[model samples]
Target: MSKTHFPLPVRQLAVFLSLLFSGYLLSCTASEAQSDTPPLNPNGDSELALLMRAMFDDAQAMKQQIKEGKTPRPSLDYEKILTAEATEPDKAASDTYKVHALSYLQTIKALQQADAAQAASLYENMVNSCMGCHKALCPGPTMRIKKLY
Candidate 1:
């Protein structure tokens, strides 16, 4: 058998370099694993986000009540939508957004005033209101809001 040989000092140096390179690679991987995730907002979600989440819940309940032919007196003060501060304050300040918010509120009010016989359509209108506003302003929730139908 033939053996490849290196001088003792050269072999030790190669071994030392291999160990050092392995340690560097391991440290790099560890650092990558510890990379920071998104930081939570210190002040928490905007009032508008919170309000919308509540509205979504109320709508879900109302939808169920509607299916059962029961009147849904959703207690959520949807008017708060106008005054609530949004996550992106600039978007809330726009004229287009104001109109959308008013449109959404009107749909909710209509849904509330309608009889059970008219509720399915009114509820559909309400969902459409959300869809329209979200589609124009924030498309992120559009898919989720579609499930309301």
Candidate 2:
């Protein structure tokens, strides 16, 4: 059999690309779980919960489009929904909760700029951010958020 060799630079590029692909796959899988709709809020629907429920629906639509190899346009109301104050107050005014919420916004910005190649991954990251916040501030919805992945 003839010996085959790849040049050092070419091999390096291959390695880098492989690592990037692996990371993307891991990110996708890590968030992959069956997302179920959150149980109705016991205290009745708060404005924040309503906004999140709407956002989840929009995200699912975007995910479906991505799975179909289509580019998704960001929802026009996303920013407005995100920035609106919760009609019901959080249990506490903790910085950690605020950070997670901010991360969601930043992830949305990333999704807004995503191309076809990047949209799915960005969407996964955004979902993960939602899960992270819920884990801290409202563990009840964690499983539901996981399904978004």
Each candidate: what lDDT? 0.87, 0.77
TM-score to true structure, per model: 0.73, 0.65
| Residue-level error in angstroms, candidate 1, position 95 | 0.7
List residue ranges in candidate 2 displaced over 4 A: 1-39, 80-88
* TM-score between model 2 and native: 0.65
lDDT of 1: 0.87
Best by TM-score: 1
- Report the Cα lDDT for residue 73, model 1: 69
Q: Where in model 1 is the C-alpha error above 4 Å? A: 1-43
How many residue pairs clash in model 1?
A: 0
Per-residue alpha-carbon lDDT of candidate 1 for residues 1-149, written as tens digits (9 for 90 to 100): 22578878899999999999999999998887689553334567889998998989889999899889998767798989889999889999899899998998888888879988888998998899888888888998888888889
Which run of 10 residues does model 1 get worst, by summed lDDT? 36-45
Question: Lowest summed lDDT over 10 consecutive residues: which window, candidate 2?
Answer: 84-93
